[model samples]
Target chain A: MSRLQTRFAELKEQNRAALVTFVTGGDPNYDASLAILKGLPAAGADVIELGMPFTDPMADGPAIQLANIRALDNGQDLAKTLQMVRAFREGEQVTPLVLMGYFNPIHKYGVERFIAEAVASGVDGLIVVDLPPEHNVDLCDPAQAAGLDFIRLTTPTTDDKRLPKVLNGSSGFVYYVSVAGVTGAGAATLDHVEQAVTRLRRHTDLPLCIGFGIRTPEHAATIARLAEGVVVGSALIDQIANATSDAQAIDGVLSLCSALAEGVRGARA
Target chain B: MPANRAHGALLPSFHSPVENAMTSLRTGPDANGLFGSFGGQYVAETLMPLIHDLAAEYEKAKLDPEFEKELAYFQRDFVGRPSPLYFAERLTEMCGGAKIYFKREELNHTGAHKINNCIGQVLLAKRMGKKRIIAETGAGMHGVATATVAARFGMECVIYMGSTDIHRQNANVLRMKLMGATVIPVVAGTGTLKDAMNEALRDWVTNVDNTFYMIGTVAGPHPYPAMVRDFQAVIGKETRDQMLAQEGRLPDSLIACIGGGSNAIGLFHPFLDDKQIKIIGVEAAGHGIETGKHAASLNGGVPGVLHGNRTFLLQSDDGQIIDAHSISAGLDYPGIGPEHAWLHEVGRVEYTSVTDTEALEAFHICCRQEGIIPALETAHALAEVFKRAPNLPKDHLMVINLSGRGDKDMQTIVHHMEQQEQHA
Candidate 1:
């Protein structure tokens, strides 16, 4: 079985939803970002999505945008993001890692080289926010050949007809956008998320992780009841943005992740 | 985990819906948004709701006879469509090469050709019972058009413009304000056209229910590119008949400046089947092609998706859109319309770039020789005539699309000239 499928199977057996944590790589500083990534699995994060900063991130809300700005200001590039991922992988094992961002940097790096470098760095999946399933055919085959899952996002707008296409190409848990707009724009609606997740269940057997607008423990718990995993992005980045030191930032993220995990566990029970 | 099962099972099912939709739309030349492998609806999942909604609405709107009649009335009465094809006798003689004719879109009511699409969109908004109209503008021509239509229809108008543009094109800002449209100055991300679009999309998402987004160009997702093209088809319709009557035949070449490519597409659509009529599109090379400052989409851009559609865009290695610099505020956009990308790929239209200096030269040449001050955006097209005129025999005739007048650009030009004088 693939790493994603194996991970999902284990989670299913345990009757537990996965805890997905997102952090902007090189945010605050590169060393701090590396330390946080190394510590995440121990702090109850089952999956880690390291965000590569871009100049104009249309899908990101204020919190993550600010985090990305900080990262870019500190000189984070594709090489730097990859190096950080490599360093994190050296000391840690078993925790699945995904690189999530826009497609320009990857396109610039050359798709084949990017996939090779990502696979070498122990990246299990990728979620390019701007790459839709229709356009992903070019990247998907190469990524799959490299044994990396090309993760896809299904939003409220992703109809029943389009869901199968998204899921078919996607390997790692499908990211269900909880809102129609950018990340952290509003509160997660359980009713809408439930409808999306229920609809998605008919199309794919892969784990479904609800994200975008997922803020509090209550929000995570509500979504976790229906979803196989819950990914928190803008809220965690917001906390990290306000932290004075790397340790303080990691501590805050760990607490948030733990609380969210507990909520998911409670809902599962 | 095998490829055989995945591709085999999925290919058959996927082809059906896409094929059905393509057939319903009667997509010509390009196969299902192929556009010779350039145009497609490549957008994020979040934008699907808006894209689908617009596509469904546009499909129904296109077939509705009442919608067609309302659009026609607005085109005839509001925009004064079938705009004159005036012979630039003095300018043609001065050029000393081809006989030039100007498709005087500048004479359109409220100024510029922007109202052609604005009138159609506003009428559609009214039919949909939309209470508010929101738009993004760079040159303020589109903002003025949208605001004018909104005022006529008694609907609220909100226009987002770049903070830099508001200062550079202050006259247009003032005009929009006087027209009772709230002109929101966007402060983020290079403070230009792309930023204005970003702000507009945010506003649209926030007010999706009661608002109609009056996109200024033949860009954006599925329905927008096709919808705007259909509305602007009046330009080509007028040019075709007017040219036949005046010149006794179709002009040898048709040229238009491409911003988001609305004006170029407007002129190019009717002549698509002519095969013999040479089509040319001029892109803004702000300083020079080598100077790394321009909005020449096809010449200095790669394929990418933005604003809900796949097209040629000036983007970084990471896919973030770069800030486009041009003398003309209207042409300062990173991405071109998807159809232009298709045209470039298929070799249907010969795409080229004009430097800021070359455009300014053309601007002054037209003013001195023809006694007409063309918009900087249109000057790009005029500049191309100079380039082609030197190579062609004197008998060759070229029709240049005089998209808009230079009134809105006076303040910007004055400021630019002052900066140049200070440097010198």
Candidate 2:
């Protein structure tokens, strides 16, 4: 079994949701960004989604967009991001690392080479936001063939007819976007999220991870009770945005992740 | 994929609604909304349903006679149809070679070719029961045009423009506001057309229920490239008839400037099957293509995805979109339409570029000699015309789509001339 599966199984046994913490690779700079990433597991991030910054982050709100700009301005590219993943793997091997961003970087990097390098770097999954199932032959199938999970997103507008098709080729956990708007723009109601999770459950046995607009520990806890995982991206990046210095940026993100992890840990109890 | 086609539609479609599986690579944007391996619905899942609806509606509307009738009525009376195929006698004599004709799209409503597509899209928006219209503009001509159509149709209008464009084309910004559009300044990613498009897409995704995104160029997701091309094909259709009427034969060559490639594709699509006709698309070389600052996507770019479609883009090796630099705001985008990418790959239409210096000279030449104050965007075509026209035989007929007027470009022109004077 993959590290992701093993971790999810262990979490299922623990009867608590997984805290999926997201941080852009090389935000501010590489060393500081890597430090924050390496410290994620201890701070309670079960699954780390290291953001691959692209020039145009269309689906993202202001906070994540700025995070992308910060990362890019600091001279971060796909190569350095892989290096960060490789560095993260030096100590922790069990925690699954997912690279999340738009597909152009990976497409430009050459999909075959990217998937191989990512697997070699101890990366477990991919959440290429812009690549849909229709264009799966481009990235998803190739990534999966090279032993990486190509996670698919199920948004609020993903009607019943499109659900099965979206889930068919999808591996790993399904990312349930709680709102129809851009990421970090609109918060999803617990009632809406609960219903969405239930609907998605009928389609696939893949662990449903809800994200988009779950900002606080309360928001995390409320959602943690309903899904197998809780994704906190923009809120965590907001920490990096609010910090005065690089060290404070890492400090701010880790502290917030620790709190959110605690909230997820307490959800079942 | 064939099951996805809209059934029993009336008028002929731009494409025959091919299967999405891409069984054959002969034509483009198959049922899956792909142009060979280029275009697709590379958007958030929240937008899939909406994009599908748009594709279906556009498919149906293309077949419906009422839609065509209304569009023609607007073209003839409101926007001004068949904008004169003027014989540029001085330009031809100056060229000392080809018999040159200008397909004067500069005479269209709003003083540019932008109104051609906006009218079609606004009517579709009305048909879709959409209460709001949103558009992105680089030159601000599209904003003024969209605002004009929205006012005509009684729909609420919002236009997203880059901060750079907003400052440079302040007159058009005021024109949009005067036409009742709320212009939102987008300050991201080089603060240009591509960024403005990103902002507009964000707005559409957020307000998908009530809004119809009126993309100014022949770019974006599936139906948009095909739909906008179909709307703007009026330029080519009229040119074909006008050429047949005047010269009794198709022109030896046709040229139009490209940004996201609407005007070029508009002129090129109708002539795709014409064996004798040669089509050329001119891109903005900015300072020059060698400087890595131009908007010549095919000339100086690689294939990548941006703003929801796979196309040739001026991006880094890491797939980061490189900011495009151009004196002409309309051609300042970093990417071209997906179909242009496909057509370029297949070697049908030739893609070339003109520098700011060359375009400025062409702009002045057209104004002084032809008495036509062409837009900076249009001047790119004129630059190419000036180059090739001098070498060809006088009997060799050529038509250039003057896609817009230069009234909105005085500031850019004045600014450039001043900079040149200082250097001299």
Candidate 3:
């Protein structure tokens, strides 16, 4: 089994939920983004979702959108984002890294070449927010061939009838959007998250990572009690955006990561 | 909430599988969702149920005799379908290569062929009891068409356009606004056609129950390509009858510019069986093919899924859709319709690229010679005629689908001309 699968299995055994933190690669600078990524695991992050910036990000909320704008302003493209991941991978190999972004930049980069590059860069999986499961055949086949997981997202609005098709095809943990709206919009209601997770569990045995509108340690803790993982994206990126310097940004993300991780751990204990 | 719950259950099966599956499969998107390895329903989980519902509904509706009767009535009364096929006698003689006929979609009520598809879709939406109609546009042709139909049907209309497009295509935007339609500017994603589509998808996702996304072209998921093509077949149906009467024979060549490729498909569908007649689809090569600035799908694109269906798309190595550029805003799209992709792959149609300069030259040539100023989108097809005319014998006939008039593009063309003179 791959390291992500192994890590997920271990987390399940320990009755602990994984903490996934999202940050835009090259948001401020490549080196700074690398530093932040390298620091995340030690700061209590179990998985790092490195965002590949694009000109258009339709599914992203304000925080991640602004973060992407900042990244683009700094001249971050596909090659640069992959290079940053490679840089982070040099020092840290254990923490599973998921490359997250819209599909345009990747499509511009040839699919086969991207899968090869992603595998070479030690990317464990991908979460193309806009790439629906129906269109994921191109990415999923190559990813599976490369021994990399093609993570799929299941939302509350996903019809129960079609849930099995999405869940069965997906590998790694299923990234379940807790709410119907875009990322960073509102808090995921506990009942809604539970219902979605329960519905998904009926379809697949894959770990479920609940995300979108996840803010505060309490929210993380509450989600941890029900799901296999809790992804803190817009909240962490918002923290990074407010920080003054690279060191300050890393510090802010680390603290938030620690608190969220501790909250999840506390729930497990 | 209770009503919505009931609607949800009814909606899922609204497009009955048994009825739609056969016809839907006959189109580009196969049952497995491969449109010659291009079109598939690549959408979010939240939208799947709705897309499935729409697909099923489209299938059932297509077979429903009442739906067909209603669509036929609207096509005749509203869109003025069976639009004439005028022999461009003056221009044909001036060119002196082949007989040329123009499929007079320009004579349609809205002065474009877009209303044909809009009338059909709006009628379907009304039958489905949808309250609001939302659409996206680049050159505002589709928006104007959608707004016109919505007004006739007395439905709330909302059109999303790129802010950049709104500024550049101000007259069409104003026309839409004046027609009791809310024209919302989409400021994201380079502020262009793709952005407008994204915004429309978002609106549909948020307000799916109350809204009907009147996709402007033959692109999008399964039912749309087939539905739009069915609506547009009127173009071909008229041309076929007109050709038999006027030319005494089938035309040797048929040409149309491809944006989302609805107009081209409309004209191309009826003739797909006639293998002798050459069907040429001209794509926009913005600067030139070599400069990496173009929307020439067959030349520069790979088979991939975007929006909702598989088609030829301009994308990078990683499968992210690249923004396409063309002087004609209508043709500024990253991908073409799934059927076009299938047709190109199957060699049923011939695809070529037309540069901005060539299309503009043709635009001016037609304006000066024929006294007909065609939209830049149509100019792409006109460029093909210029290229093909020299190769063909004098006896050969070429019929071009003059999909729209140039009224919507006057300001853009004038501004472009001023810029060119300034540079010179």
The digit string of per-residue lDDT tens for model 3 on B1-424 reads: 0211222222232246664444332345567546656666666666777777777888888899999899888878877778888878777777788878899887788888999999988878887899899999998999999999999889999999998889888999989989999999988776788889978887776675688999999988767787788889889888888898987888899999998999999999887756567888999999987888888877798876578766778876555567899989999999899888877766667888899999999999989988887888999999989888866788897889999999988888888899999999
The reply for model 2, stretches above 4 Å from the true place, is B1-27
Candidate 2 residue-wise lDDT at B154: 96
Off by over 4 Å in 1: A159-168, A194-204, A244-255, A258-269, B1-31, B127-129, B317-320, B390-392, B420-424
Judged by DockQ, which candidate is best?
Answer: 2
Number of the top-ranking candidate, with lDDT as the measure = 2
TM-score of each candidate's B chain against the true B chain: 0.90, 0.93, 0.91
What DockQ values do the models have? 0.36, 0.75, 0.38
lDDT of 1 at A91: 84
lDDT of each: 0.81, 0.90, 0.83
Q: Which stretches of candidate 3 lie over 4 Å from their true place?
A: A9-16, A72-83, A102-121, A130-137, A242-244, A267-269, B1-27, B303-305, B316-321, B368-371, B420-424
Residue-level lDDT of model 2, residues B215-321, one tens digit each, is: 98889988999999988989989988998899998899999999999988888888875545677899999999999989999899999988889999999989999
Model 3 DockQ class: acceptable
Root-mean-square deviation (CA) per prediction: 6.6, 5.1, 7.8
| CAPRI-style grade of the A/B interface in model 1 | acceptable
Predicted model with the maximum TM-score:
2
**What's the TM-score of every candidate structure?**
0.89, 0.95, 0.89
C-alpha lDDT of residue B158 in model 1:
99
Instruction: For candidate 1, write residues B36-59 as lDDT tens digits.
Output: 555556566666556667667877
